[model samples]
Target: MENQNLNKILSGEKLSIDEEMVPGTIHLVDLEGTLNVKKESGSQSNIILQPQPSSNPNDPLRWPKRKKLAQFSLLWFWAFMQAVAVNWSGPIWTLWTETFDCTYMQLNISSAICFIFLGIGCVFLQPTAMKMGRRFVYLGCTIIAIVSNIIGSQGNSVQVLYVVNLLSGFAAAPVDSLVEISTTDVFYQHERASYLAWFILALYAGSDLGPVACGYIVETLSWRWCYYIQIIIFGVLLIVQLFYMEDTTFERIDRDDLEDKIIQQMKSRETILSAVQSGQLSQERVNSDEKLNAIVSVNNSINTDDDDESVDSSIPMRTYWQKMRLVETEYNDSRSWLTIFYRPFFLISFPAVIWGGVVYGSQMMWLSLLATTQSEIYSLPPYNFTTPQVGLTNFGALIGSLFGMAYGGPFVDWITIKLSKRNNGILEPEFRLWTMIVPTIFNAAGLLAYGLGAAYEAHWFVSAGIGQWLLGFAMSSSGAICLTYSVDSYPKLASEGLVLMLFIRNCIGCGFTFAIQPWLTRNGLKVTTWLMFMLSIIINGSFVVLIKWGKDFRRATKNNYYKYSDPMFGELFKK
Candidate 1:
């Protein structure tokens, strides 16, 4: 009987089950009036009554809070290590130029090559993660990074260094996108900004810390020791990850239970038919049974429908593979890769990204330039500071980063959640931008101070302190606002948006770092600082326009922005 019912359900026939059947038992019987026998069970019918599909307790989000923290920590640590490795090459750029007898342009090309590969890595790593899973991809990339660092350290030729730099950038690509994605996967929306902020803090902190640590090493030991430091950190991170980070893959829900329920209903109908053929029961009895069975079957169907709905709603519509191939026709037909890449350019084209590019890129440029230039400017007569002392200038940026991390992450998150609640569970990605106001003012002030301080050759400490606070605040707020807004505005295309931002930001940073030195030497720091200040004013001032009219903008270009399609978009825009 069970076999017949199972087969019937598998074949797409609906079955009705009794409400009083024994638990875990499949009952096959005829409905009181029906001419066919079908499977009916009270307990099996109840399976559909549950509201949600059971989540695996082993899932990363279900892991203990302490475990989640540990995972987050490990991610931050690896990010920091990668950041350090990137800038470690900065302090040693002069050394490489002198040793290899390469021109400044060639030396800059080495760093630029690393950054270019970083962007290329971003494009491929996300796709790789979808196939092999995030854990495997992260581990593989870190290991490759470790090996590249060691090889680069041992290389004696400029060509070898360039090749190693490119490879290292490729290997470290996962650290950028994967970490951000993983953080979002494991944490709730409210907690994401804070966690992301922490991640960025570690990233910038490494930039500051890397040069200082490597400068001392390069001065006392060989430039090769700088790469050695990265290898050691990578080794430590690799072990930490193996034990702590678990795969956060979304589970596939099974439909076998639904199939089985359908089978049981079929068997009940078959039983009724057989009884009629055998004349074991009168027509009256069969009719009564049929009515009872119909009621039970309807109830069972409802339960099954409920279960299916719950399961469907809990899982996101797009899976990892679908997201991986969003641009490819093999995955979706709505749009092409070229379309996806160019869409944002046409949509928001707000000077926000351009300004963000300037803010972030210029900071990196100035930091690198200042590190090398300080020695020539201040080390000779009055200060006579060594390479390590010059590296200490990074202390301001470091201090500012710490302060930004503490304030930006939790504060932005709290404000977003509070604003979301007042708005009735609807979140406008614009709420995240509110916190940027202060950071903008600070950033503008910092640029003005750093540029003027350098121009006047004022107290070194004054310039460092101003630069630190400004860049620090700007990094924290601008980064937080840009990411949050991108995610909220284009949740479906969040990854693509991130890729665009990353590419623009890195390219700008690389450009400025290469050009700032020459520009400052030719134009003077005062002139350059004013240029940055004016840029910030224009960029920061746009926020007023956006905050006041952003919703109108979103509504005007409904096709361009996904936030418009969201049910909450209309209501939220009213506020």
Candidate 2:
């Protein structure tokens, strides 16, 4: 009976059964055929078929609007918690120094390790997610992070702290990459910049909010509570995810089975037609068979054609694992990860990434320096606050992040959309870039104010306000533009491009934090910050060059970019 049903289905005979009963099975049948089958109980079922391989409305893209938004929100919250966990320890650096018997530099090393491992983990986790699928990778990484947090909280040694920080960073990598991919998966191309802007805003908000929350906690309770707090948060997020997050990977509809069914149906139709013409088949039988065959053939053709058209019309799909294989091949031939590392180097080596890096790095460096400098410079007897209070200077960054999130992100997207429409539906990635001009000018002015304020011992609020407003807007605009531009310009290699930007940006930030303090102390805040302000003007000003010549740059580098695409961008660029 099973064999007969299979033969009939293959021959494009329509079978009557609940469609849900054949879940995960691919049926290929002619669009114009009648399917008849007898059950074990001698019950006959007949289906007047249309075609095989019909479009299933069960795809993630076809999900209900509310359900889709809920998915995005859940992923956003997941990313936020991961960001908070990594940076929560940042504000409590002083406590760690005292408890672990380490210097400020040593504590910085631990924080740096978290970021460094984040980059390193992306190399592995991204490919793993591509291979194993998003849901599994995300769930697995969250579990690893939970365990890492538990182990980190119980650690007594500095060595253990460093190891756990690195492990936790490794575990956290999937959250960012997966969330970005998932957001891209659900949103349309036109809507991506805004969605991504929000995602980044959430990310920065978590980073900024972490210190304030952790500062209050460490001040009143033990430093261990910071980790404990994250553990609880992670637990709650994990539970929410288990109940809410749906799998979003693209499931390919099988074409081979459908093709075979169509072939069989065509043969069955010819047999029935010949029998009818020769008068071996009755008119009733002939009519029924002809009607069924027509229905099945049309159905099969439409299904097959739809599947073929979809594959032809859209970008080729390759899992990250498959791209990694190509990368490995290239690596074996070239004996280098140059293809991976050099992707962002072109952009990084560009004056824009560097200048952006300097302005951004300087902000971070000066903020750290000013925080610590407060106690020494002020010298108020009672208000001689400890390192944590100095760390409270991070609140400036928090304030800036909020301003950026609230104003900068949406402004960039709105302006870009308007400009894109003005260009007759052509959206240059550079459209989103023009919004950076005001922020750039403001950032330089902010630095200048911070410098004068700090050097002359002006009101603390003066330095904080200038720094916060400038840094907030600068971080918001630069981060939004750089990321959006890279994704738009190199949508295929967006992940790699971002990784490159992150590498150079953070390297500058970390390097300058060490150098900026000593340099400012020796040269005076006025000279140091003025120099930084001048440098920012130089760096931020280069956006004009990028906005004008970016397409030219892309054209010049197209060959290399195309070669890199095979390994870096996967099948997306093949379009």
Candidate 3:
């Protein structure tokens, strides 16, 4: 029976399923631009749809395409800075250790703390964005970043550096979650994956560019130039935000349509008053007249023209300074404020959520290794490299990352569309996991090559060079795909999900950093790297485990966040 169903699905017949097994078909895309929603829902187009955009012109969903471009341009610039700040210390750890008389462990801990705080800060910042508004979070965080950098630039002690790191992490945390949330708020489902890939690129690109710039800065200038440069970047960002970032949260209750009804009521009340006074109407209607009078008195402030019910765009656009409000509505939902701190921990049960954390976190280990090990490898025998030369080595990883950024989105989207077509237009979240197969093979191959080459004392071009680039390509592509899949599968709770992913990713990264020196010293470079490579294979391969069990996990966790507590697994609880 299952075989027959598969054959029918392949032949383009609608794949049938039990309705109670899933929620509404809002996310299922069996065909491009068409969803396989039940005909009983009364969709005129015979398709299920979502993100059912509001008619409000002020709605971010309905904003002019030109405005969308302008808004995103500003957002990307700001987000790139946050990304750059997080990894600034990685390449400069050698300088930091010498300057502070601290050990490598202490320096690594300081860097990892910044990453950890990013997740910690997001837990509060995201819920605040949903409650108070994203505009305030974005602008406020940028301002904080500027102040943190200035203080960091002037700091003379190691303790001051630690405080600077903490403040930087806290201020930049909102960009990690809220920027992605803003993307979803503005774009449609079809465009989400591609746009998210762009976001990931801007974010991770910092990990690369920071090293490159810091390498040059530390060699030619003072170590403090790193902080100085960031201060300038963020200072400009703060000023631009004042003029460019508009409050996108909207409440479009159309009071203009209420104007006509209010006018007629007022006219009726005047007639009633006249009739009663002239003795043509009974005093019994006096009670009704009084009610009518009250209604008119309340609605007298409404302005209307003809029967135009559209929201008022007639008012002049707010001035640049006037548009700086973080949240325009007086509306408040207290529960939203709590989500930032609470939801990430609760979502640990979902397979999709686990994959997001594991895949992203594991791949980040390799990147962190590159940052942690670059100076040691290049500065020692076989290659006596200067600080600038050490920084240039990151170019290998950067080049590989550029490949992932350029091709990862299109590859994921193409495969998803193709898989959905073959499965009778049913677009399962699991379909995206297939993109991992290619990148996984590359990851294992690259790790083996790097380990073996390093162990055998092979040419730097082979082990440290090509191997690093391949690992980078694999990590960048896999991280992008995994994150996109998580968002695609469980977007209703993506804000919380992102924070959790960040925590898991940074912990794993920090874990790898701590283990790198110990493993190398005890087992030698080749053996330790090979062991890590083997472990990475297992982690990357776990995607299959998720694909098999993910649906059940989603059902268990599905819509649960909406109620703060809810049922799952469709009919499992029925007795």
RMSD of each: 14.5, 14.4, 14.2
Deviation in Å, model 1, residue 30 alpha carbon: 48
Residue 310, model 3: lDDT of 42
TM-score of each: 0.69, 0.66, 0.77
Off by over 4 Å in 1: 1-59, 251-382, 560-575
* Local lDDT at 125 for model 3: 81
lDDT of 1: 0.60
Predicted structure 3: lDDT = 0.66
lDDT of each: 0.60, 0.57, 0.66
lDDT of residue 221 for candidate 1: 93
Which lDDT tens digits does candidate 2 get at residues 9-43?
44666543322211111121112323321111111
Sorted on lDDT, best first, the list reads 3, 1, 2
The superposed Cα distance between candidate 1 and the true structure at residue 134, in angstroms, equals: 1.4
Cα deviation of 207 in candidate 1 (Å)?
0.2
